[model samples]
Target: MQYPIKKNSLVDETIRTIRQHIRQQTWTLNERIPSEAELVELFGIGRNTIREAIKILAYLGVLDVCQGDGTYVRAVDDFSESIVLLNRASLHDHLETRCLLEIEIARFAARRRNAEDIQNLQALLALREKINPLEDLEEFWIRDRDLHLAIAIASHNQALHATYRYFLSTSYEYTKLFIQDEDLAEPDHPAHETLVAAIISGDENQASAYARALLMPTIQQLEQLSTT
Candidate 1:
């Protein structure tokens, strides 16, 4: 099926349209995105608009398309945008995303991480431990942020590392915005211990799953509070 070219390309508009559809449950991950023909008909946009939108979503890790195979939702839980939202998002959202991303990546890191990466991660973890539990909130968060950065950098993917770096910066500033979230100020969270153990033991699934479990309660707590 051929899609008509638009007189003026609307890449941003196309993207917005796609996002709305996804958010509205019009399409799902692993399901084919609306065809270019459908998009052209509905939006009266050009083929270039459709193509650009597809390409951008693919970059954002939202949708996947194969040359022979149709496009599919990558994962309903895909958090590329979530990571990009690290800055503007709430502290709770930031924590949830970080825990999920790290644990998943940590599992991969356990299997694929090189010695140098391991060393780097270990050093960062150690540095985190040296900070007094009684330290100021700012200092605690600094070390806390460092631990997340270490894991991402240890993954050794330039794109992943860079994405996480930006997330860290945003999260650091945003975390400072709240003074009442004291639980995260703890110097030793058992989840971090499990994370390190899993990485060292080369158990990716264990690592990622543990990381998710560690943060799940906090997410629930946040939800409960938000409702009230």
Candidate 2:
């Protein structure tokens, strides 16, 4: 509320500061934001400028503007608004983004993981391996995603961990699309096993290589699907 406001672009600056406040949890998710009058006073801006900023954020899915009630925080950020398109993006595109996220996650995990992290990852991977995807794809997918999530958590990077956690929910739906359409075989569990081992051993390059190795087959499958 006490942010410095530049004169020329009051609306944009108001929007930016409001977003910062939300990000910092000054205004929490589902919590109603300050009223236009309060915001006008807090920001030293006009009612019109405050209303316009709130309207723009509401459009971006970051805030929910109610009829009689005040505006409320809808999501943590704007990424929630674009999830529909992200889920519908090409299989190759999804895999490409997954590669970028997971590869870095693996490297960070390798460098940052502790004994407890190793133990947790091993347990998740074991549970993942035991579930035959063909028998129970949903259960198998959940376990698989959990193991990757453990690795992301082991990275000890809050921003990266949060981003991956949010992204995985979107990717899971699209991943199911290819698995159903292509009748894909069981995932390369051994490759994942090696990736976990690399992290435990603190070998960053090996961890990253294993992570990429695990995803390469899916990329190739998507390419083949496109060609056919």
Candidate 3:
């Protein structure tokens, strides 16, 4: 089957179309997905685009690619698989994982942050402050991501920074959904300011505490949501 290519974000559009097909049960669970050549022909895109889309799906556990064999459907729902993953961690587990990484990131950032890192953090915070979460959730999220990534960059530990990004990528959709919940409140801007202050002052303990403070309310809310 042929699919029309859009003018913008071709790879994203392609991925969305393929994901839609899976969700609509165009293909059954455990069924082999169309071959790369077939997908390239179907989507009217290059082989590399098809490969990238397929790789993203496989990474998200929606598809299982076996070399010398073929790619098969692993899950019908991308969002569900994203939050729970194949390992079946609880929602609280996911929140705790984020909390653990971020707290240490704050501490390292406090110890290692340089002048440029501070400037980046301040700029990201300024951008974040201007965003109205109720008005533009997507932009709010993007700024939020930038702010956290700025902190990670301040950490000056390449391995830690990379791991933090990996976790953020996997949890991105879930975090987006959580923030969009009407019952969920916006992030505490004052807490962020305080966290930045601690980092600027090079106070590792205070920075860690502020980071935990920033994350705790959301964690409590998630815990409450899970039970209800």
Candidate 4:
């Protein structure tokens, strides 16, 4: 359980070693790996370092940290996970899945959204617009995802919300391919504003239309790319 210390980059080294163990099946899927205290002792590192490393891995979906419960192995290997994601579905597949989920999500959000959900969606929309994608494209994408996630949460369907989040995480890498720097330079995403307005006004049909509108261009470009 002990790993050789690299001294300078304790946190990064710990993270790499933990991932190595997971990849090697030293920790198996769905199994609770170890407690924070045990990991600190096993790694011979400070608790803070171990905690930080675990935090990063949890964010990456390699580990799942439950409050009061031990961290569990959510995935076996990062590289193999990415390979499987690549092989299991194409970008077009991810987009089609998005369309299927989002249309209903928008419809239900429009029907179910309360004051708080509307406030949150509006706030996220404003925050998303402020980000100049030309300067920070990745951050813009994250914010955009957060907004869509908020809309899904507004649907009041826990299963649908969880499923959408799972698919969103899986499709994230492929979603990045749908836009380029030049494409994002101007970034005319006015449909987002209207979509929020539609949800706020409880207009289900309009909300669905705007949701599909937001994605249609990307789908078309993907089609163009696949052809070429």
Highest TM-score: give the candidate number: 2
Candidate with better TM-score, 2 vs 3: 2
List model 1 lDDT by residue over 1-228, tens digit each. 433334554786677667777877779757897677777787777677688888888877788978876787774545655655544677677777766676666766777777887787778777777766445767878887787777776676778778667767776565554434675432246668778778777887887787677667767777788899
Residues 102-187 of candidate 2 have per-residue lDDT tens digits of 99999999999998999999899889889877688799779988999999999999999998998888776765765676554324
Candidate 3, 1-228: lDDT as tens digits: 588778588778887888888888887899998899988888788898888888998888889999989999998766544544623655567777888999999999999999999999999999999988768877887888889989999999999999888777666666666667767654578889999999999999999999888767878887887789
TM-score result, candidate 4:
0.59
The collision pairs in model 3 are none
Q: The CA-based lDDT of model 4 is what?
A: 0.83
Off by over 4 Å in 2: 1-77, 181-186
TM-score of every candidate relative to the true structure: 0.56, 0.66, 0.60, 0.59
RMSD of each: 8.0, 9.6, 10.4, 8.7
Give stretches of model 3 more than 4 Å off. Answer: 1-91, 225-228
| Local lDDT at 194 for model 2 | 90
Rank candidates, lDDT, best first.
Answer: 2, 3, 4, 1
Off by over 4 Å in 4: 1-87, 181-187
Best by lDDT: 2
Candidate no. 3 TM-score: 0.60
Least accurate stretch of 10 residues (summed lDDT) in model 3?
A: 79-88
- Model 1 spans > 4 angstroms off: 1-86, 177-180, 183-187
